[model samples]
Target: MAGPMISHSPAAPPRPGPGRRVVLGRRVVLGAALGWGAAGLAGCGAGREPVQRLRLATGPEGGPYNAFGRALAAATQGHAPAVVPLATAASVDNLHRLDDGSVELALAMADTAEDAVRGRNSFGRPLPVAALARIYVNYTHLLAPADGPVRTVADLAGRRVAVGADGSGVQVVARRLLETASLTGGAGRVAEVPLALGESVAALCAGRVDALFWSGGVPTPAVAELARELPLRVLALDGPAGVLRARYGPVYTAAEFPAGVYGLREPVGTVGVGNYLLARTDVPADAVCAVLRTVFDAWRDLLREVTAGARLEPRFAVSTGAVPLHPGATAYYRSVYG
Candidate 1:
């Protein structure tokens, strides 16, 4: 009478064997797969939209533009969308990509971007694009060895100089500056050797070349390393200061590299242009907003990551001459400041 009514029949079919347990596990796995498939279909129809992918074209490896591109990729990884960075030839090439729909984003020198959008200077046709931000300034430095006699731009006459590789922004500006200084004549020669930055430094140190022109961000690693090991002098281009400013529309500014800033004995005054991020006009507004948000939000983190990042600021983003702001980026700027 005690447990007659509560007795389980035959111990409820005996606990399942290992084989039965295996079957049960298989059923669970199958059921989970089906449920996930259904949820995914539902998500496609009514849930969050799929993440968008963007391709950012940057400069040559080991350059400021490339470094910034990498930082941008890291910053936007966990964001709503995904961004991909493509290492390419510097500013001019990047502009071409933006125009042809080859890339959604690009890192370009402000001067180059200006030229592209207005069909002036390097760009032969008007390119439809907009600026996302001004990330840094590319200071044009004239690198000469300590014992070399090329003290100033004037002294470069009758001397060999490496004006960077062909199609490089360095070469374009170097030629312009040389022309302005009257340094390009039968007596003076420019060797168009397409060498990497490291190789150019070595060539200069070895006396194979008298001078090299480099347009890049402050604290450039190649220049810094060369300055440390060898006695180097960055010639102050003072002869055509007024001419460059007048011709280039004031986007060109006279900036000083203070003594010890790059192991220099005295401050060196040089001309420079700001660097900015460019995007094709066709990029979605939402994507542009996401990119701008990521960049400005992680500005501090980026500064710590790259030397050039320290110059990226909201105010600088709007300080451009020819490059117009993208509507999305302008919206973000107004939201943050106003």
Candidate 2:
């Protein structure tokens, strides 16, 4: 799928599509929209019984995860365990909170989830996490100074580069990109600086670093501000994108950054990584089922807030590589697809 570009002219969100009830062979039991059947089944599981509560870990304020999490929380208000969006440091932090039992649900980048499952990268040990659904795509941004000497990701060798801060998912993706670009752990490695999005922008504009790697939705406020202050150059990420997808999962894809977000006249070739809704494995299947039901049944409401949320494809839900589907989510899918 092409990386979604935010459209200035918003279209009315589409109504929730038909729902599936029972799977008899390959024929799907499409019936009365999403809620009719899902609503009935909501109380069938262990998720939202009476006053059961849940916390949804979202990205920092104003980020995509926060916005979508808020929409999701609102939709599930009377459905299952109460879901409250918890503003956090984003992907890596979300996963950490999920493992520590501080939160029951979270939003995380696919690569971050992959690393967590394998006990590599930022994660110290294997975490029992599973996919609730494959959500939206996060574009990988390789930004450099407009007139800087660096022209490509590989050229940053010996130059200063800002990955994200400690315990941030941006850092995980940044490190992976650099390793693939051959800019780390070698004779000509670049100088690494870790900072948050806003800080990275300031550092880049102030000449603190020659390049910065930011992975996020388009039109990130900080990047937009940086673009307005000085002409910026976006390095092409298509080169290493394929390798990343193969090493990771189909969650990573070759796509172009949307044009006009930063006053660009054309799209820039970049890589896109998906974000997922994850839950701890021990969550009741019925609860997972109820939440998934509410999520899709209220899908259109979410689209109104995050246009890219229209990409919540069902076929991709069960295939979130490296992580198993939560039993509740699996049950939901089987009932519909069986």
Candidate 3:
């Protein structure tokens, strides 16, 4: 029988008039070749052509996804397959790439991944993607000028808040959080401002925005910079810290932003969601399994090399909710944990 076919559609063009053209330039072809290489081990049957590369969709430069991708590439290189990292917009974009076959592997937020698989949130239809591993949890940090009046998540009502670029995971979760806190749809409570991560800090400093919500790893450069130069406070969500986990499923958990993690005077309680590695349903099982093995075997070393705070223990790598685990990755987890 022939293997499953994966489709690569053009990404929705940058916002403006009609969506931007989905450019299938040389990079797309290169990405496809890399993806094949990463999954090559599964095609080793007699008379099959050898696979050459694997393409991974990472996030914007300097973000946790990008760093993790680079580390993953380094760990997988020459062991199972040659891996290439394609920097993308972030979680939502990464999931779209995985669904459209633009890349074989991607990094996604558990919440966003849940929405895509269930067609519940931003994704209008169910997406055909599966999880390889749950890597780490992203703490939603609501950063405001330390002296600002916005002391809680609800205080941002009616104020200009940078929710990250449109279609980005930041925007998706920010809206959900606002609604959860009852800050949306009311007069003078919530104003969503779509801005890139790079521009969000400047916008806040210039007083164009009152607060900025970012979900990322510890010591993010943007967050650290803002904390150092400005009077910044990381706000605490209103409900109990574990409320999201209880209502939304185990994908979220209560996490602490330690006091002095970024020069804060005290620890701040918040909700967090995991980040997972994802792939299209059509990816070969053997290839996926090989990649999973490589990542797991090198988890500690990769964590040390990428970000000091990142923890890749096997205990934190299993998907808990709407996100479906890939068969190959499931095998890997069973082999290691069982």
**Best by lDDT, which number?**
2
Instruction: Please give the range of 10 consecutive residues that has the lowest summed lDDT in model 1.
Output: 1-10
Clashes of 2: 4
RMSD to truth, every model: 21.0, 5.7, 13.4
lDDT of 3 by residue, 212-262 (tens): 988876667778877788989888753544556666776666667778866
Each model's total of backbone clashes? 0, 4, 14
Compute the lDDT for candidate 1.
0.68
Candidate 1 TM-score to native = 0.80
Per-model lDDT: 0.68, 0.74, 0.70
- Looking at model 2, which ten-residue stretch has the lowest summed lDDT? 24-33
Error of model 3, residue 106, in angstroms: 0.9
Question: Candidate 1 — which residues are off by over 4 angstroms?
Answer: 1-51, 305-309
Q: Candidate 2's residue-wise lDDT over 21-123, tens digit each?
A: 3332111213221333554334235434443667999877766678888998888777657689999888899999999999999989888998888888778
TM-score of each: 0.80, 0.80, 0.80
